[model samples]
Target chain A: MADPAANGNTDSGGSRIGRVPAGYWLAGAFLLVVPSFASNFVMYQIFGWSFILGMISLSLMFLAGYGGMFSLAQMTVAGLAGYVVAICGTSAITDISQNWPWYINIPAALLIAAIFATIVGWLAVRTEGIYTIMITLAVASAFFYFTRQNYVLFNGFSGFNGIFPPQLFGVDWRNPIAFYYLALFWAVFWYLAVLYVSRSPMGLALQGIRDNPRRMAALGFDVTLHRVAAYTFAAFPAAIGGILLTWQSAQISPGTAGIGPVIDILVIAVIGGLRHPIGPFVGAFVYVILKSFSIDILVALGMAGERFQLLIGLGFLAIVFWSPDGLLGLWAKLRDLNRRDPLIGRLVRRL
Target chain B: MKTRTLLAVLAATFLTATAHAQTLKVGALATLEGTYTALGEDGMRGLRLALSQANNMAGGREIEIIVAGTDASPDSAVRAARKVVEQDGVELLIGPLSGSEGIALRDYSKTQPHVTFINGISGAQETTFVDPSENFFRFNMDGAQWSAGLGEYIYNVKGYETIATIAEDYSFTYTQVLGLALGYCAAGGEITERIWVPLGTKDFASIIAALPDDVDALYLGLGGGDAVNFLNQYQQAGGDAQLVGGTIMVDGTVLSSKGDAKNALIGVPSSGPQADTWDDPNWQAFVKAYQDEFPPDQRFPSPSLMATGYYNATTAAVSCLNEVGGDLSDGQAAFRSCLSNLVLDAPNGEIKLDGNRQAIGTNFISEVVELEDGTLATQLVKIVPNVNQTLGIDPETFAGFGVPGRDVPECKSSY
Candidate 1:
């Protein structure tokens, strides 16, 4: 009989192995500590944003990479969480709201996001791959304009702003570093937890279904249940990321859930080498860094930075043509080279 | 053969590189290369003139005014914002050319706290209302603030009993209608109905299908491309609606983008610091200088609103910088304090940033008239200065004014 633990993930030696490769945890730990030595601006701004976005992309990885499903609504899901935070609780303030304490509003917002995600998942999962994408895309588009016109709900175009984070542990997490650590803390916890879940029997069943849903169903696996669970699991990360985004920017609007941004999540996952737990982080890192410098390169070429997409388009095309596996895959090849170079190792020892 | 061809191309390109690639980086993220690219280019020209006038030196900085024309997409706006913040090394930012862009660009603002962000007419009201870090400020009147003069003019002054809200469906457009309705409602008037169409909607038949004939006045929140369609269709469909627009409804630049729709629109636009306010000889001379530097089509009439926004927006940022001069560490407190306590002279008149850090400035109510040039024009008739008066509320206060929020809808549009 097969083991049910770690979602019943076992090696030939009969020892349980985690869903995430061990390297992923090491990388997460490495990233967590880098902020300590980094500049406040780097730690607070660039690194913090990367972590926030990484977490969001992590949810996408959970859905698309592991579960073999692609839903555009994860970004929308996060945005919904952001809107709830801005409009519901203590963060709701005098602008989006006049009353509400932090404790009451945040959980309410999170719960609302999860419930909405559950409903969306149930409806979206009713259809297969491409249909799920289309349905979620439709939902996202609906949310985008709905927030714009429904004055009573979204306050029309003005959108809710000034969504303040709680002074958790009596520390003002609004500080860039504080926010950074908060993001890092959440990211690490999820990394560990998801790693655990992916190796579990449920994870294996989900993977089995991904390979051949009909066979998995005949084998007595609840295909529908597994898909729903994947989406629900994905929603937890997306919701946290969205809530963090709201707190980070202190605002929420239709712009957060717009189509362009929704699609970019796919781009991030594709670019990060969508093979493992570390892929989302790698993708987000490159995306942030690419954006950080794209405008300057454009300006140097006498092109307006505002129109930098013309240049970025070329870079994206190059990446797709040259390395289909993305930056992480390229890094792996380079690491392989380093391993094979005896002279390099001898030189390293001499140094 | 392919590699040889590549080498030849690389060599050819390398030889043509500029000797001194000294780029003057003027940072802008206007909607210039997409649906609203024309408007974005117009904003770029506005800043170009300002840069040329200053010889590209302001607060002792020389920039090439590097542009990051957005496709009027929020994600594109962020890409543009990143360009300014990281690549162009822009001391400040000027636009995203739309309300949604403004909202997202402001989120990017936190990522580059040292770089000041100014709204380029992304008048969603929420941009600088409450979530505004000291880094982000809008010079131009917000969507709600622009319509500050409308309610009184349409209802109290013109004595219209009921009005219908017809606008493009989006936050900025929707909020403008709401602001007008709020103003009208506060003064004991009712909005007959609210009809919203998509931003690029070419036909208004569906939305126009619902207008009750009882409305004596029509409140227009339609803008740019959608405005032209709305007006063109409203007239063709024989909707007997008298127009009272939110600022850009009758703007010359907006008309330029629509090509022929200039002839169909006639009304009082209530966005402030308009060109007619330059009726004073001193300001007229500035106009004459502006005219001499650029062709007629290049001249922006609504500099009354836009330029004032840029000036006030920059001033707000600088005030914070001045207080925290040479001290980047505690810049946050000084910025918040500077913003909270500022009362500056904006070209639109005196602008005071309320407790919410939103500016209260004079708004103009201008009539659309035929100029001698035979072009449709907005002639200044009245100015409603400081529409907010004493109401110092932020976006946080503003959004929660009525009801609760629902689940933000998921994206439904396919790329």
Candidate 2:
């Protein structure tokens, strides 16, 4: 049987980077210097949003890819962190916000989100396959409704606006350049961490459990403990992304973590490719670019701007139809073709 | 061949750049997606009509409007606003149809001092009341201002001494309820119960059962689908309580809703920014212009309140451009000054800004009545002129009532 879950995954963390790939070096350099030429909108709205979204989706990838848990509550965990920040930190809703310092609220938000995720994991882990998705979706839906209805804390339908980033190092952290670097740093940190963890013994054990839970249990591995731990680990990146997202928008509402966004994070993870660490970021960049420019594209094509959703849906279907593993899988197939058919590959390369 | 192609490309780029410099760029934002799509379409129609009246020329420059759409989420609104301001480089932004979107944009306006923001149908009280932005101007009345004269009309004319309220629980509806409760209680009226329902509620069985039977009327502060749903279920349950409609409950959006339940809305007294059948010449002209501008199939018989709000905002922007000769240089200081003091003779009424740049305009108390063609429309009963954000109460006294919420502005009479 083809191991679809483990497809394209290679190496353990102990196998260190033997001769770092040229693509990685080039990508790193390009990202570091992007702000020099990019406009404030590109840096702040496009790249900054992508990095935050990528980090959240990366948390999902870490679960579905390494631990075989496809939890939809990742976005809810992120949203919970954002809500904690708005409630604890300063916001325009003077009556509701406590106006605590960022130092107190930031850590508090992370801890609360992590704890919430742990509880959700404990409940969701008992279910397998499709049931897990249904359970996570239910949790996410409950959070959305609760936040919408509870005015004393969550501020009901309107929620909270004007929740700006605190000034750090004499810089408005929400400034386009500053926010881009902030989001980029967190995204990269989580990316490397997930990559390293996936190769570790813990990651292998989780993968074994994913393949056969009974076999892993028979082999003396604590399958449930590892699955729950994966959720806790995933929450950190999602929480950090949530904090950055709230800071970027300067507001948090029930719609921020509503059913729409919860599904969007999953769509982002799956489209980028679940087999590797870089897949989610690739998917996120595509998604953000499409969202930002779809109006112009539709208008240029002589179509109504409201049809952008149709375009996105079509693109999503095309990608999924041709490459079941996602864009990364498509790229891998192209590379394999180049190696297998030397004459045709050389002629195409020459052109 | 390559040299000729390159030269042609350079020439095309130069021609486009020069053409762009001769035109003025403005951004128009609306919730073109999600639940408020119909409202947003009307807002855009209002904007286009105003632009067409100006012949798309303001000051000495040709006006160029860049349109952006949002899903009514604050995040999407901000991103759309940022793209137009930072990427497309618009001098002024007119937009954002939802309440929360307005509050978020008001904060965003603080970050962009050079770009002026004109409110478009966002009736959130806090948008201008709290930490108001200097460059942001709202030409439409807030939710509280829309509730003017409704309480007195209900108590004195309708002989409703005791009433209960059923409102969608949100900031905007809270402001409306606060306005009604304060006005009614001050006029020797009493409120027996207040039931706050979440938006998008489908069932009204329990709510109808829980309503106090002794109350003379039930003040409905719900809007959109919630209003339609409640009315349908309430009718099925054989509800006979006299209805006092909120500004939105009797709006064309709900009146035009498909169902026989809307018949329950007939003779229901309500108050809002404008009445559909007002005989005022300006309003008649506006209605004619709106009908002439778009096909009958595409628009309602009367322009929606959202359409009126955007029309007023666009008129202010366009006239200011004329006053300043379209010169928006030096951080738009001259334009801002002209806008702040300029009185707008809106189709509904004469609108002027208060100290916070929020509109102190007119309100109309009306009752829903079916027209000759069997279409429902609000007929004018009373006109409340120059109603301010504070609902005519003294500033200190109004502040004492605190921000609008579940129990805010206390329903009981102080006397």
Candidate 3:
């Protein structure tokens, strides 16, 4: 039951109000120049997907790390936003899309996704541990089947294709550079927002509930309400990620919210490290790279290319075994070793 | 001066020929993992066989293949498609072996206007007929097109009055059910009930028990492992309804694995390109090539519909590439024009694209039978030729058919 407020420095001295970290500035500068060095495919397929998927996994990571809720329905929340975008936006398959303006569609998508997540969270928060996992999983499974069968609304199993990001302000947002920046902006915004919230009073209360719900309730905090509120807050990022995903692929289907993808978000979060806010993005980077190129590597190795999943599984297993806290935890351990050795510490500090 | 002019002309000709010989990258996308892996593998084999047969050259241009694997999901397929087009810079694309994936890839084709996308066994109707992409061409029949004469065959030939339909709940199965229901109801047959099991469902006990006892036949639209499970369970449940179905119900894997359940399809006519049934030279050559590539001990027992579909698609692509001298710089308009009016003697007969760039060709009414080697194979019972995407119905009426579901055709009376 770690106190959330103790995790980061507060603005007690007022030396730096909302100061941007040097590491963040460095990372931001690098990301801004990525399109110049990388190809359009790398921009869209790798970084773009990594950011979007990172955000989705971040939602799960937030719930698990801060609120002690392991939700399997984060992807479902994202998928709901995707479906709302498709239902509201124009597509090639069905005539159902009202062709609403982006301003209306974007907000409506987020609202619907948030509302859906809150309801699911309300139901899920009543349970604890594995029961919570099972309930979220059930909700995810139900949504998948519902979208698959309900043709009139969800367009049956095919769902909707040709769901492009609205071309606003005389620019196609789906263009590689624009899309990358859009995804990056949302991802970084949510990451900072999550960091800020985890230190906020409500975040402290939620963490208290996560650690000891009985004590929190006895102390006059509505534990369930806080947990549900955490879910509603988390849904914003997941929903935004979903909207981006729909834009990236220009489509939405049952497979978007399928069980495999639902599990994948958990895998991404765990592999990146659930403890830190940046862990999911790290995991997403590895995941997107592996998914895009592992097949080629397998084929080049003179093996069946389809066995890429085997490679991915092996990588995930090795990472989990190496550090349950994920890549970030592994990094922390190396950093500690560096600090213990003066020469190594100097080299790291110089870098 | 005359000799120098001759030398210059010859040099110019050689340079032009060399320039035209530039390598053309073709990307093959398929679900290499998950439930449809075998189908995807077969499609790859089929494409490879076609490419090898052409000496890996089309229209005097060297062809380099880049294979991309999807997990049979639309999201994976789109990502894979983006990789092939944007990263690999493949001029031509083939495959993505699922119904939803096909539609996704078709929509994706709109974004990649310069790249020509050919279908690789995905049979969703919307991939072509609903919102056809100028850049995407399907050289094989869609699910509905495959169901061309199954309803009429079952009603008039087999004398089935009322039928119950059990299909996977997806666009592909829906199109299949619509194809059969339209023909059967039109031929004075009634669809008593329609049961749509979700994709990946293994249990058919509840669905079987729900079937009407008076059903004269049961049309199955399940595929691969799901079909095997359902057939076995349907048999164990003591269900005696005469089982007929779409092409997937009688696939090679289903025929070989279903054991006694395969008897349900022994005399029933389904639709697809079965090698044993369609005895054309082109068809024979394809089967022979496939058998040569994959020996008896190899993974695939025989060329499945997926294999043949891709084989035919690649074959058409190569033929067109040859016709146009392998130059796709003009992009979609050039490829579309080359494909639209051209007809090739494909494995399934004459393969030609309609105005919508959908396949208009033969649909073989096939039945399961024990081959000389004791292996079960689908034998050609009848041939439905020149079957278009419309499935013998008027375009307007077919459009009005709506999405296929339970009680779609409005059964008049039970015989």
Best by TM-score: 2
Rank order by lDDT, top first?
A: 2, 3, 1
User: RMSD per prediction, one decimal?
Assistant: 9.3, 4.8, 8.3
List lDDT for all candidates, in order.
0.64, 0.86, 0.82
TM-score of model number 2: 0.92
Per-prediction DockQ, in order?
0.07, 0.34, 0.29
User: Every prediction's TM-score for the first chain?
Assistant: 0.85, 0.93, 0.93
Q: Tens-digit lDDT track for model 2 on B1-415?
A: 1222332343233121112777898898988877677778788889988998889998888988777889878888999999888878888899888777888899899999989999998887888987789989999998888988888889989999999899987777888888788778877899888889976677888998898898899999987777888999998999988999999899887898888999999999999999999999999999999999999887877898988988889899999999999888899999988888989999999999998999999999999999999999999999999999988778877777777778887876762
Task: Choose 2 or 3, whichever is better by DockQ.
Answer: 2
Candidate 3 residue lDDT tens string, B124-201: 887887768888888888887788788889999999998888888877887788778777888999887788887778
Docking class of 2: acceptable
Query: lDDT, candidate 1, residue B225?
Result: 71
Top-scoring candidate (DockQ): 2
User: lDDT (0-100) at residue A197 of candidate 3?
Assistant: 91
Instruction: Summarize candidate 2's per-residue lDDT along A23-142 as a digit string, tens digits.
Output: 666577667887886778878887799899999999999999888899999999999999999999999788889999999999999999999999999999999989999999999999
Task: Identify the superior model by lDDT, candidate 1 or candidate 3.
Answer: 3
Q: Which residues of candidate 3, in runs, are more than 4 Å off?
A: A1-6, A10-21, A88-95, A214-220, A341-351, B1-21, B258-260, B332-336, B400-415
Q: DockQ for model 3?
A: 0.29
Candidate 2, DockQ score (0 to 1): 0.34
